[model samples]
Target: MASVTDLQYVALAVPDLAAEREFFGQTWGLTEVGEEDGMVYFAAEGMPHPYVIRLRRDDERKTDLVGFSAASREDVDALFEQVKAAGAKIIAEPGPVEGLAGDYGFRFFDPDGRAMEVVTGGAQRAHRTLGKGEAIPVGISHVVFHSPNHPALVEFYQRALGFRLSDWIGDFMGFLRCNSAHHRIAVLPGPPALNHIAFDVASVDELMRGLARMHESGIHLSWGPGRHTAGDNTFCYFITPNGNAVEYTSDLEHVDEATWVPTTYQPGPNTIDQWGTGRIITGNVPHAEMTPDKGLWQVPA
Candidate 1:
């Protein structure tokens, strides 16, 4: 199976370009790599990829598309053929994007109308390490999509793109990994939209520093600065200027694949907040009325 090498970049549409740009630049501290046409790209430290986040202005705020790098040119070709053979909604044939920096690829839509791209190359990194106390993310870690049918999306990812199952948060959610680091994409049972996009930081200290930047910008944490039992990563989530959820996370556990086992965790405090500091927000909770209050299930400090 020709699998994706890693997540490349995610393009999201925001209502206000200036506000979203400000939040990502000054608040998030991500380096402005470059701009093309009308979109701006934000570069992450330590990763050779050209950009991790792409922003476009639109009247409606929502996710635009998610890009994944294929293992090679041949892999791109193979996947393109497979997608076409399966009669998926083909946006473009496998080829080089005229103005884009990367290699040849194709674009398609998932069952829920989410745009997904698979390509071999577009841009290369300049090879730089993050400085001390820097809060800028290293790269995009993962994207969680809220789908109306979790089972169908999971099957599509596993059967169509070769994403391996990492774990499950009950029957309502599924985590799928392409090249380790727990999961690159997750699916949840709800309306189709971007749940949250997580970025990798250097350490817990750096994650806190990033949180501080958000605090300085008057953006409050919507969910956590606590650990999640599933990914085993410390997370802090906040609402973006366009109202989409974004997360700063560090220390995500990786799977060996050979020895890893997927388990279904019941919806509870341990599954939601392993360290017991985060509240159940509407971001990850579809039906809040059925969830217990934060006080009832919190682990004692």
Candidate 2:
């Protein structure tokens, strides 16, 4: 069974549900889809649930990354078995998530402690509702995480979750593809920190408009308006209603089975984003030249 159809929403637990909704609703153009108990869900109107951020924070801006959807129903079942075989404990059975519909899925923890899910209804439901976010900044495009043992964690998802590498950003940052979407998940080798959440815009122009709104609203711009060397997305990063970084991205490259190649590149100021937008020393990231042992594998970085 093949894995990954598209990114289903990466659920985030936010302390202030209303405030988070208000910010993303007004600013990011998300529409509130009511709530369960105290948890509110927002459908990024045009995007699949990929942009829906859940309100269930146990701590400050902490999101347990649940990787997105799988392409086929068989793939979803395959992932469930694969997860168990791969040593991840099942938190939820492969079925409906209670509140969400058309989604037959399950949640499992990856090798590095990241929680992920596999489903079939992911992109389809969002597609039927809003078509595609190509006209607006759709929903969650990717989630980047920082953790130790980049190789083990990345390998776990690739083998168990049906994710493929889109491009390798040095030895530490890897862009992975699930379905036809360019890169749905990216892992930056880490001492462990949650990096950012991304939303796709209709066009690079839409992305810039979102960035401009974020700037006018006084949120800090972390990086972007540059094309990435790995995913080749024209993107901009900013702090969200909560402390987590959020990104508005556009025009990311796509990968197919035919020309799918795992290529490597060296990371530098100019190399991170070829159009020159990604700036800032994110952290103590090991460069490609420095790490002789690492290459593009399903592992973390």
Question: Where does candidate 1 stray beyond 4 Å?
Answer: 85-87, 280-301
Candidate 2 segments exceeding 4 Å error: 48-51, 57-59, 64-67, 71-73, 101-103, 121-136, 278-301
Model 2 alpha-carbon miss at residue 174, Å: 1.3
Candidate 1's displacement at residue 10, Å, is 0.9
Q: How close is candidate 2 to the true structure, as a TM-score?
A: 0.83
Q: Compared with the true structure, what per-residue lDDT tens digits does model 2 show for residues 29-101?
A: 6777767766666677665553356655444455544556666667778778878888886767677655552
What value of lDDT does candidate 2 attain over all alpha carbons? 0.65
Tens-place lDDT digits, model 1, residues 1-301: 6677788888877789999998887788777888888888887877877788888887767667788888678898888876666557877878876434377888887777777788777768785778878888888899887777778888788766778899998897799999878989988876666778889888899999988888888997787778887888999888888776788999999999799999888978778688776765445432211221122211111
Question: Residue 74 CA error for candidate 2 (Å)?
Answer: 3.3
Per-prediction tally of clashes: 5, 16
What TM-scores do the predictions have? 0.90, 0.83
